[model samples]
Target: MGQPVLLSLLVLLAVAQGVVLAYWAIRDRRFRSAHRAARHLHSADTHAGRLALVGEIAGSIAHEISQPLSAILTNADAAENLLGEPDPPLDEIRRMLADIRRDDLRANDIVRHLHSLLKRRELQTTMLDLNEVAATALSLIQPVARKRLVTVRSCLDPMLPPVRGDAIHLEQVLLNLMMNAMDAMASNTANGAAERILDVTTDRYDKYSAAITVTDTGPGIAAAYRPRIFDSFFSTKQEGMGLGLAIARTIVHAHGGKIWQEGTSAGGAAFKFTIPLQAA
Candidate 1:
């Protein structure tokens, strides 16, 4: 009886081990799939693509690093001048110190965001509100548009369904498109189009997907360039290195979405990207 009981116990142990191994294999497979998608995004195979990505990464590093460093230097200069005063106001110095800290934190955030943006990471999806992401992007762009003397308006559907995507990356994608729209408008200086209106909207594209559109009051992409606008190293702007649209396309594709452009009724450019909505 004792021998029989021991054999049964051993068999049960083997079954448990098989279950554990099977579970890990399934999880690893999923991870590998996601990792492969991430790898394709950053992988530079073609010569032209690599060159464009390198230039983009360099310029982005410079832009991200310089802003906060400039702010820190400006604050330091102000603090130094304040220190030279016979009656140095502690309150003022304290404010400067706080600002320096804030800017330093901002620089750190930029570094982190860029790292996440460029690094190969698995796409972690969650049910995310598209309107909220659009709203946040608009709030951030409003100040930038104001500085450029452009107006940004939004008409987001409050009842829009949630999509499965990484929220941070979605926001980045939205901002990228809006920035392109703004740049398109900025280039309109030659066209004498004074009305620079950037209209952003979100609505249901279909029963299974939702769309976000950014329309700009500027000359739309030429027929020739429209085909290659999202291609690597394709740029309309003189200073553009042409990585933004490529990156945007990759992100949207990875999320099982599609992005495209067209000429809007307002005689300007419009870009619309759609993502699959999560099932109820």
Candidate 2:
């Protein structure tokens, strides 16, 4: 009787071990699959596409960085002149140094933001403030907006909740929407719409989601094209590959959010997207 019971116990242990191994194997496969999909989403093609957008504002970026550099040089020259004086104004020289340092940091930040966008990497999730993300995107695009004479406005909600997602990807989405808005208004500058305005706003869509909207004072989407606006490779621009909206939708959806366009019969286009707030 004892021997029979011991054999049964051995069989039960072996079955439990097999089940555990099977479960881990399936989990590992799922994890690899998800990782591969994410890599594909942020592939070399996506990076190239982003670089193309950067190229559009390359001159503006150069000018933005050059301004700070010019300031630093001017301050340095003034400080040198002060040193040459018999009774140099040490106080003034200190102020000049401070100005130079500030300009240096400004230039560094511009480069850092640009570099972060250009880098190719996997998605990294973190708690983020949508307001800050919008502000950063605006800072990066301000030079371009100024060059094009587009008035940019932002209304960020101070009570906005934190969201869980990749900040870089979210910024990319915001930049894409804002760029598209600017492009939409480009033709309007010559047409009836005299005021070229781009508005970005952040707020809570509901108890669980934070939303952002990018609106433009351009001619709204036609009734015919409204349905397939987010479809891949459906660009209205002659030189556009039509992936911007598609990618934006994908990224937003991946974060458990939704994106949609508001009708603008009066004259203007609004694209809004939401990201779910982090759970308690």
Best by lDDT: 2
Superposed on all Cα atoms, the candidates' RMSDs to the truth, in angstroms, are: 8.6, 4.0
Tens-digit lDDT track of model 1 for 1-280: 6999999999999999999999999999999998886575454322233233334345545665687899999999999999999999989999999999999987786566545545544457899899987875565455567667787888999999889997656766787787778777775663474588889999999998999999988878889888899988789898887777887788789799999998877789889999999983
lDDT of each: 0.78, 0.88
TM-score of each: 0.61, 0.86
* Top-scoring candidate (TM-score): 2
Residues 97-132, candidate 2, lDDT per residue (tens digit)? Answer: 999999999999989988888888656789988888
Which residue pairs in model 1 clash with each other?
none
The stretch of ten residues in a row with the least summed lDDT in candidate 1 is: 45-54
TM-score of 2: 0.86
Lowest lDDT block of 10, candidate 2: 41-50
The deviation in Å at residue 158 for candidate 2 is 0.6
Clashing residue pairs, candidate 2? none
As a whole number from 0 to 100, the lDDT of residue 263 in candidate 2 is 63
